[model samples]
Target: MATDKIKLEEIILKAASVGPYGVTDEEIRNSLPENVAPNDRLELYNSLLQRGRLQLKKLHGKLFYQTVEEQIANKLQALTAEERLVYSQIEGAGNKGIWTRDLRNICRLQQTQLTKVLKNLELKKLVKPFKSVKLKNKKLYMLYDLEPSVDVTGGPWYYNQEFDAEFFDILYQQTLRFIRGSSSAVTVEQVASYITSLGISKEKLEHGDFESLLQTMIYDGVVEKLYQRSNNGSSVAVYRSCRHFSPFATLGDVPCGICPVYKSCSIHGVISPSNCVYLQRWEQSLDF
Candidate 1:
């Protein structure tokens, strides 16, 4: 009986190790040893649940069995009803985070009351607030332990809720240098690997970030992307420094090229190019 119990525990642990999303009942059942009786397995499963070793979480309308740490469970249990409600909503938002106004509406709590609850959660180190890069003035709340999504934090291109143009320039220059220094065309993976090895960023950067940088370079006419057939006849994209790149401004070199509000700029409107501060600044910076 003791041996059977140990086997059941091992199987349960194995099934729960898949990921944070947890495993389904069907998965758990398939993992159980054939010799273990259905009633015996049920007893062990119930025993774990009663002891708070496993938590049943409903995600996307389906129930999953997730293993929760005892300390975390204890912390959650200690939360007041309101705090739990707020926390659950923030957790549902995931890494993207929930805005304070949105949270208020969703929780149906008054502004003053929501403020107090958020402060309490902050004090308890259960949740935190951060400014989103897209909306610098607005703050978003998320679970304390989660890293904000790239969409919220604007990846590594931003710092302190502001775009770090200097950092971006450094990456741009370094990427160009790598491409120019290489004898042959380089793949995005090769360029990303090279940039990562340089340890230029304090925050983690994804491969897509470097790929975007390369794309920008391509747009600037400084680098060109070429496709080459691989050993298995798959086309592989590779980048090389342009041999006869034009010195004239490419689309991205102009102020309007990368402006977020370019669509709103009209010939004789409030946001026309004549009154554009960005274009004015670019003009002033030009020596000629």
Candidate 2:
């Protein structure tokens, strides 16, 4: 009986080695010795399942046998139905994470119940909470093993859910310096390559990030964007220092002059002049 059990265990382990798709019952049976009694084979398979060494899963329309780590199986088995539901939702959200309110709405759980379940999951190290840079006050949840996406965390531009103004300022200065040092208008690709050569940023800066910085410089009146025809007859955007630009120029007193999102501001939009905090603050600071 002991020899038969060892042999069955080896066969089960071998079947599990096929990976996540798992093996069908027919495959497992074929791998087993023909001399083994049917009853003994069933008992051995049950023993492995009961011990959490193997798992039976139904994928598509077929049943398969897959191996699961004992600890993971035990942890999953120990979860309550509510905890499992919440965990699955968080897992489904992946690294981007799901907002707490969204999770509650999708799971159809009361705030208190959801909070309790989240606390339990956190205690078990199955999930963790993060703050979105765009919505700092709201909490987001994701699997503990997953890292938050750049969109959720605002990439390297944010720290602790707050915009790192100093970091932005440093990049701003460096980018402007590169543009001013150039003999003529430089293409966006050129500026990006220059920044990459500097090795100032630990995280890889995308081309769009550089473009955004250049846009902000344009807003600040320190840089000007121009379109030049390339050899292929395609128009390529280029940047150069604004020779006439000055910090104390005519538009210096107006907050709109340097607002990065100036183009997006509209009368009926979210960032309209009526609710423009910076403009209001500037107006209030002026001498009566």
Candidate 3:
């Protein structure tokens, strides 16, 4: 009888070993030999757990069993049918992640159903949701253990889904400091050179990278963009720091500056700035 029990337990472990998510109690029952009592199966589960030959994990209040080596695999067995399908697509997506709409298209699930499955996956800690930096309106889903690609996370321009205005502000100050000490207007290339010289960027700065920052400074009314005549009769664009520029200049604090949903804020959407209470409060704070 003991030998027969060992054989049955081997069959259970074998079934669990095939999938990364291991096997659930129902799976074990289906694989068991005929005439095996439910009590005997439960006893075998307990025996395997006690002897450290198998591990048990509870996800969504259901038990799954697998070997210690396949622990991550066992996590998949915990998902509902829809959740498993969604998770597989996400896992196959690797770091780049799949978009919400794309997920629905691929899975052929309705919007409402997909939303529920995503929420459940999030609750189970199986996946994470991130807003794409380049496509601010797009939400991407990836495995919880994975780090999103720079494009999805907004590269270095953002910090944890929020724009890193402070970082650019520091860069702005640095640019001004470099210009104030110089006698002539600085070309964009020169500015890029100065930024590169500071050893601040993990990767080397390219001319294109500084263009965005330089354009931003011009828009902020702190730096002037000009054209310098070249010896070849062509023109070279240059930047001159505003002589009376105020380092502490700002238009004023708006609610979006401190709002947590600022990352997803849009003019027309579920999380639009027009519908924000914080923005309303800012308007109300001023006396008419």
lDDT of 1 by residue, 1-288 (tens): 787787787789679768877898778989987776888777877877766567677988998987756666667767778887899899888899988999999889999999999998898788999988887888899999999988888888888888899999999999999999999999999998898899998777788898889888988889999999999999999999998877544755688888888898899988998888888887786663
Worst 10 residues of 1 by lDDT: 245-254
Per-candidate TM vs. native? 0.78, 0.58, 0.43
Q: State the number of backbone clashes in model 1.
A: 0
Query: Which has the higher TM-score value, candidate number 1 or candidate number 3?
Result: 1
Which of the two, 1 or 2, has more lDDT? 1
Output candidate 1 Cα RMSD. 4.9
Per-residue CA lDDT of model 3 for 1-288, tens digit only, reads 989988997888787776665779888888888789988888988887655567676667887887643445456656678887898789778789999999999999999999999999998788999777676788989999888876676665676678888877778789988877789999988888888888776755567668888887777778888898999999999888787765434444665666777788888889986788877877787654
Q: How many backbone clashes does candidate 2 have?
A: 0
For candidate 3, what is the lDDT? 0.79
Residue-pair clashes per prediction, in order, are 0, 0, 3
TM-score of 2: 0.58
Q: What does candidate 1 score on TM?
A: 0.78
The predicted structure with the larger lDDT, 2 or 3, is 2
Order of candidate numbers by lDDT, starting with the best: 1, 2, 3
User: lDDT of each structure?
Assistant: 0.85, 0.84, 0.79
